[model samples]
Target chain A: MIVDIHHLNFAYRDSEILKKIDFTVKPGELLAILGPNGVGKTTLLKCLNGMHRASAGTVMVEGVDILKMRPMEIATKIGYVSQKNEKARLTLFDAVLMGRKPHIRWRPSDRDLKIVEATIRHLHLQEMSLRFIDQLSGGELQKVCIARALVQEPKLLLLDEPTSALDLKNQVEIMLLLRHVVDYHHIGAIMTMHDLNKAMRYADSVLMLKDGKVFSHLHPSLVTEQMIESVYGLPVEIHNINGHPMIVPKDSTQNLCC
Target chain B: MHLHDGQIPEEYRKYIGRKFVFLLLLCVSLLIALLFSISSGAAHISLTDVVSSLIGLETSKKIEIIVWNIRLPQAISAMVAGAGLALSGAVMQSILRNPLGSPFTLGIAHAAAFGAALGVMVLGGGIMTSNSMGAVQITNPYLTTVAAFFFSIATAAVIVAIARMRGTTPEVMVLTGVALGSFFTAATMLLQFFANDVQLAAMVFWTFGDTARASWSELAVMSIVVTITGIYFFCNSWNYNAIDAGEETAKGLGVRVERVRAVGMLLASVLTATIIGFLGIIGFAGLVVPHIVRRIIGSDNRFLLPGSFIGGALMLLTSDTVARLILAPHVLPVSVLTAFIGAPVFLILILRGGRK
Candidate 1:
């Protein structure tokens, strides 16, 4: 397993954030986390990378316990893309090149430079490589951030709302790009997403959380209409649109008969 | 193991080459400025005599004394102090992620002033006597500098403590710095209020920031400190570049953010404290030179650090030269000229609104 979390729990002081979460993902697999607001989606991602220490249980990545690893050590094995999308004062090329920090010696070697250039090319950000990040649109900035994460060459990738700021076309492109990266690099990607239909369509597996508890953890094909309604506290219908499952909200005006 | 030799894109190659040319120009200009400052002092030393003296060739005794004893040391001191201040300013701005974050803006200058005032009123036995312009000769210059260093570092400690308690948010740090500055300014005012005429004269002169005050010994100290610290800042250039992104992003890039911030702030404060201790309060070389250099060289700290140093030295040398020549013989303080020059340029930069 690329990531193996068993009975993981996290808390902020006295308030529990994640409760007994257990999940395992292999390389080249995309695991999409679905949850309502304030349901510990982001907290779980932080725990996997040891940004927030787990209160109980173990998180093992590549058969090594993450709690024992140094931040620099973990950084080489896992790349995390945060949701805060503020542009830094850096050219796009330099920003992506920064991802190689963990692997760099005193200075960047020829190999490091080649890897960065390759990643930027792969992302098709060559046009804006010299432009400052502040000049880029939201979609372009998101892609740069992803490219930076990709250049880390980690075994696992974690993304927090990667597509939230994107338009429809950009969102689809980003998802496809991520999927392609996972397949080509043979790395596991776990991302927290708000869009249920997108998650169902793109993710190999889905983990749904409700009020800091695991509501369901299953393959996308195994998720049912009842599971969505119970976890989200809303009535919804799941229709198979082509080969993908599409979620449609039921009529709110329909009253439940006593 | 050669990997993709010459794979660097044409644009990036051009970027590196342009930065190199820019750096070269700054170096040439700095050299020219130093030569000009050395040659144009109160004594009538021609450029030929200056060059002859510089190269250790034969020159008249009086010419040698003016160039070597008086003007060369003063110009070198100005360059060293300016480089130190500008380097500190660039590092602070990058680490704090605030454009206005500099030694002057962060209360280090005010603290140094207060310390110098304390040295004048208390340690130096309140100067000799008050003259017509309230200018009195200080009894002990070394004590004044030591006291200034002590207080500036103390102020930095307080600010760092506050940051530790309240998080290193740019808003918190800037506000705390302003508050500390006001506190130190008020403390200096209190000292001035109770001081005698001689003490007041000494205190006033201490704050005027004259480059002529830098003796050969003080210049030596400043040069050594600046060179060592400057090299240290250069070596950590990539770490600083990572920090410019954001704290969390820096951490994700495996930078120890808290450690880097604390150490960077301490070194910056030390640089500020040492220079301001010797030179008194030469403002805006720290504040303005780094911004101008950033506008020219882009925000990469690797280039920004050295660029700011050269640019800052050039600015201070020019301003000091103007201070010496504009009034001629009755020279004004270099700080006055830097303020006159730096304030308007800073205002224009702000009004133009191209600043990152």
Candidate 2:
């Protein structure tokens, strides 16, 4: 197991965000987490990245407890891409170059530059590299962010709503790029998304959460409509499209009405 | 859109040329400062007289007194305060990650003002009746200056501590500084009110800032402090670059976020403290010079810090020269002159920058 979570529980202030969340991921696999908003989707990713200190649980990555590792150590191992779409002061090259941050001190090294350049090349971000990050369209910025994380050269990649800011085509491209990262780089990925159909289409496995508890952990075939309906608190219709499950609205107007 | 091209051709060229221009500008400003500091003062000393007096030529005692006792030290103080404030402003902006961050924002200047008020009112009155600004110790001049420095430093330290404990939000940090500044200003006001007639005059005069005290001894300490700090900050300001990338990015880059931030603020604040104690609160030089430099130099602390220092020193000298000769025998306080010039210029810069 690349990551093993034993009874993870998390809270902020007086409210619990995650409860007894047990799951695991294998090496070089793409695991897409699906859940309603505010259901520990981002929180789970934070837990995996060691960004959040869990209230009660052990997260073991590669047979070592992630909690025991320092944040820099964890950062070196897992590159995390957050949802900060715009911090305009940073240029594209600098934003991407920041991925090398975990590998060096406050100053950038020659090696750091080489990695940043290579990552930029790999993502075909050579054109937008100098543009300020805020000036870029959402899709371009998302790609730039991914390139930044890729430059970290981490074995595990964590993304929170990587496609949330993107349009449909951009969403497809980001997913495809993520897929490339998993397959070509041999990096384990666990990303959270709200698009169930997209998740089913792209992810090798699925982790579903309902009210902070793990609803189920399964492959695309086993992630039943009933399971999603229960977790999402609404009636969801699932249809098979070329062997992948596409979830749809029971009532198009309201959020998955039960 | 891409990373391969790196800095655009213009920025790369700018990165090099700006440094040269900065150096050239620094030299020109220094010469300008030296010329005006020597030429323009209360006494009608000829340029030749100022030069002769400076190089130990046989000049009259009047020329000698104006140059050596009056204008020379004042010039040195202006140079030191300007450079010190600007450099600290650059550091503060970087550390705070806000464009508006400055030494004045942190309450160090206000604290220093209050300390000077105290020193002039309590210490000077109780000891030196014929005392004046920069009038060294019949008692401990250094002690009085240091007391001012430490009071400001302590206030800054408290602000830093509170901000760090509360998660270092920009809003919280800035608001904290604002609150401290108010507290210090109120205290200074209270001191000014309670002071005796002679003491009141001294306190009021000091608040207006006469750099007449920038004696060779004070300049000696200023150089030492400024040099040590300049070198130390030139080395450490890269952490500003890292943190400016974003706090988490800085942390990922192995910058202990809390430690670096606290250290940066403290260093900048301490420099402000030391400077204002000797120079007596030269206002707006710190705030304006750094802001202008940022427009040309960009926000990278490596570039911004040193650039602002030179820019600031130049501004101070020029302003002081104008203040001195503009009023002839009645010398206007340096702070009033800086406010007059700097405020308008800063307003215009901000207005133009806002358009962008």
Candidate 3:
């Protein structure tokens, strides 16, 4: 297992956001966290990466408990890509090189620059590496952000709504890239997602969150229509197309004209 | 395009090399400005004479005295104070994540002004003069400077404390700073209302912010503070760059966002307070220079911080020299010149879309 999270609890003052969340991710696995808004999906990802301190429980990456590690140490073990990134007037090359912050003290070594260069080329961003981040398109920016995370050389990756803002074509491209990254890098990835069909199609495992608690953690093939309806509080129909499960709202076709 | 053994591309190398060239050009420009400022004063000393005087070559005694005692101190003070203020402004903008963040906008300058007024009025630091102009002399410069530093840091502390309690979002910090600025300005006015003519004149004069007010010892102190603070900002340039990306992203990248923000505010505040205490409230340089530098060098703090330092020194030195020689034998306040040039340029930058 790449990550073993058990009995995780988080709270903001008196109100608890995550309660006794338990899950594990194996190497080369893609776990998609699915839920409606305000269900603590983002919060759970934050806890796993030590961005937020868990009130209780252990997040064991490999063997050591990451909760006890400093933020720099945890960053070396897990890379995180936020949902919203500001458009900064920085070159794509420099922005990707910043992922070496945890490992660099005064300046980036030759090895660090080499890693950044390789990561950018690997993600096909060499052509625009000199361009400013603020001038990049949405899909290109998202890819650059992902490239930044990949250069961290982490054992696990966490992304909060990685494709929540992209068009359909860009979304598929990002998902395919992420899938390839997990397989090629042999690293585990956990990302919060809103699109059920995309999650079902790409995720090796789906973890549904409702009311700040885990509703179900199972393979996408094992997730039933009843589970989706119960977690989302909306009627959904499951359809299998080309061996991939597709989720559609029950009345989705009836409102096509509207 | 493929990396065989982790080699950086030549194109990227050239791109990075260009920013370094820009930095080198700024340094060269600052040197020229410094020489011009030293050469052009009320005294008609030539640039060759100024260079000779600086190198301790056999120059005229009178020229040496004028260059070393008067123009050199004032010119160096302008450079040091401008560098300090601009560095502070750059860090302030980065940590607060606001384009408008600066010592003047965040009320640290106003707080220092109020503290100086209080020092003159209530701290027995002002001496009543018999001149018809009613010019009041600061009998104790240390008392006034200490007072100004105290109030300025107090204002920063309040802002940082509020940010700590209510979250270090840019909106919260900037709003709090604006509120404190208004409060301090009002308090200064209230003190002036009850002051005698001499005290009122002294208080009013202090707010004009002339770099010529500093002597050699004071210049030494300002240089030390600027050097120390500049080094601190440079060392933490990566942290500032991370914060520029956004607070959550910084935290995820192993940056302690809150700590960096609080400490950065305190240090930048100290830098601003030191300059304001010595030279009064030199407006616009702190607020406008960083924006101008960002437009030229981009927002990489590693380059931006040093770039602002050199850019600021050049701007202030050139402005001070022009203000000194514009009317020749009668010096306009450096703050007035900066505001006159900074305001129009700032407006143009805004209209041109300030950051690239």
lDDT tens per residue, model 1, B1-356: 11233256778768878988998998999888888888886666777888889999998889888888888888888888888999999999988888888987899999999999999887864566555644455667889999999999998888888888887666777788899999999999999999987788788888988787788888888888888889889888888887787666666667777777777888889988889888889988998899988876678887899999888888898899889899876788899999898888877876776555
Docking class of 1: acceptable
* TM-score of structure candidate 3: 0.96
What i-RMS does every model get?
Answer: 3.7, 5.5, 3.2
What is candidate 3's DockQ? 0.59
Best by lDDT: 3
After the best TM-score superposition of candidate 3, give how far the Cα of residue B32 lies from its true spot, in angstroms: 0.9
lDDT string for model 3 (A37-65, tens) is: 89999999999988889999999999889
Q: In candidate 1, what are the lDDT values of residues A93-206, reduced to their tens digit?
A: 888888888888787777777888888887888888999898899889989888888878888999999999889999999999999998888899999999998899889999
Native contacts present in candidate 1, fraction: 0.30
- Evaluated at residue A41, the lDDT of candidate 3 is 93
DockQ of each: 0.41, 0.23, 0.59
Judged by TM-score relative to the true structure, which candidate is superior, 1 or 2?
1
**Candidate 2, residue B165: how far the Cα is off, in Å:** 3.8
Please state the error at residue B4 of candidate 3 in Å: 7.8
Ranking by lDDT: 3, 1, 2
Q: Which candidate is the best by DockQ?
A: 3
